[model samples]
Target: MNTTHLTLDEKRTLDYLESVKTRLSQLQESIHFFLRSINPETTPGTVAWTELHSKFNVLIAKYLHLTNILNDPRIAFNPRNYTVFPFEPPANDQQVQNLSVLLRTKLFPELEQADEERIKEGTIPGLPALPPSPAPNRAVNPAGVNTPVGTADEKKQWNAYKLKVMMHDELCRKADGIFEQQRDMVHTKVRYESDDGDEEDD
Candidate 1:
């Protein structure tokens, strides 16, 4: 196994990524609480609902800020050494869904492909190539086998990729939940107003 050390810039980028992950985790917890605090009976015009909505908005702003930071060309492309460009978060829910789908189906797969190429080329310095999979005729490995594969450096690279994908998934899931709730609240408010108008006419 190769044992080359990371350069100072790479070390800083990794540290920044860790801090971003921590921030995202905290935001997820806060969003979960926000969702729980919201209820069907919570009217949109009420003080409680307003405060909760304000807090939710702040959380979303922070999330968007983080997204922008991650979308930066420097950090976004650093993982695969500029082979893949990250997607920008869209302004609407439908567009966001499209972006999420694109990431899952296209961008992420490209990153994985880039990793495979890197491993084969031994271009990532200390990371080594993964072993070839066993032939189909070979005995099938039992489920839940805990065998480790590849060198430590190779494992580290794969873990970093997993972490990146996980972070994106977590943020998108939480943000989508919050947006759905907001839409529900708007619909509720509109129905309440319509009912009040009919009662006044009657």
Candidate 2:
């Protein structure tokens, strides 16, 4: 922030350092958040599935970038004073290799597979997609009313959330009105039957 008289290269170096430091802190926080939320023994199902996946993805991305910059031969950046994270600050080359394997080979693959399965099953996230209704003349769109599939995040959002809320309220009000009319009719009929029974008994 105080690079008033520094050279252009010095400014770039400082900026890079700041970026790495910020990313490291974020990586630590995201890792801790996701781990704590997903740990079955600690807080099972505490976090939403989408939230957990998103956070973990961010953590992985930041970790990989941080490690790449730190290990770059050109930069030769040392992380001895950097904040420690779940998958960082390895003591030896073997440990670093193992960490990469654990994440890339083991953990990430399984998680991504699970995510795809969930998306197909419409189990979690923003919402599930409804089945396409058969059309008489035209074929079904396949993209149902609320399908949250695809790459763009715009596809995943509840585009009709407000509209749905308004429709729900309107239906409830109409149903309530009809229900009250039926209840009143039933009550009047019961009263008339009771009066007739009394007269017959007399």
| Cα-lDDT of candidate 1 | 0.55
Q: Model 1 Cα displacement at 90 (Å)?
A: 33
* lDDT to native, each model: 0.55, 0.53
Clashes of 2: 0
Q: What is the model-wide C-alpha lDDT for candidate 2?
A: 0.53
As a whole number from 0 to 100, the lDDT of residue 174 in candidate 1 is 59
Candidate 2 error regions (>4 Å) = 39-55, 76-202
37 Cα displacement, candidate 1 (Å)? 1.2
